[model samples]
Target: MLYLSQVLGLVTLALWLYCVFDVITTPDTLCRNLPKIGWVLIVLLFPLIGSIAWLVAGRPERTQAVTRPSAFPEYDRPGRFAATSPDDDEEFLRRCRERAEEQRRNAPGKPQDES
Candidate 1:
């Protein structure tokens, strides 16, 4: 009987400490039924009963995890632009080809016969 009482006392102490800590750590926005300070006071003062009440009435309800949509999912990628298709910028490609042909013609080492 004495041993059972000791175990129960330890359990109650653990529960009380846990509840107090929880109340203190819980965010003001998330706490229900009362403000964060109120919950902290209740848990601190009433131990087991307050802890039970906190669990039932003051604890934040579990919410579905929210997944935010990316503002620019395609363009947000690292080292990549929003425009993935080269076909969208045909003029840019045309200028690049013209520059490459002009450079080839101006090469100092190349024989004139190749032209």
Candidate 2:
């Protein structure tokens, strides 16, 4: 009986410490029912009951896992923007290359090939 009581006491102390640390480290936004400080005080004052209360009522609810959409929409699908826009088209690239060649030829120090 004595050994059981001692074990119970140790368990209670461990729970109290865990609750205190959890309350301290948990973000203010995630804590529910009361403010972070209030939860801390509660855990400190009444170890077993307070820890249970924090676990049950004060802790944040777990968010649901994000699932993939059933119908894969065009815009939301993979590689939606892989198709080249007008600026990235082959004609646009040819025009840009021609302009660069013209500028290179017009530069004063560049010797033009007379072929």
lDDT of 2 by residue, 24-102 (tens): 9888888899999999999999999999999999977777333456684787777666667877598888998999999
lDDT tens readout by residue for model 1, 10-65: 99999999988888877678888899988888988899899999999998776723
Which pairs clash (backbone N, Cα, C closer than 3 Å) in model 1?
none
Candidate 2 deviant stretches above 4 angstroms: 64-115
C-alpha RMSD between model 1 and the true structure:
6.9
Q: Pick the candidate with the highest TM-score.
A: 1
TM-score of candidate 2 versus the correct structure, residues matched by position: 0.54
lDDT of each: 0.84, 0.87
Q: Provide the lDDT at 44 for model 2.
A: 94
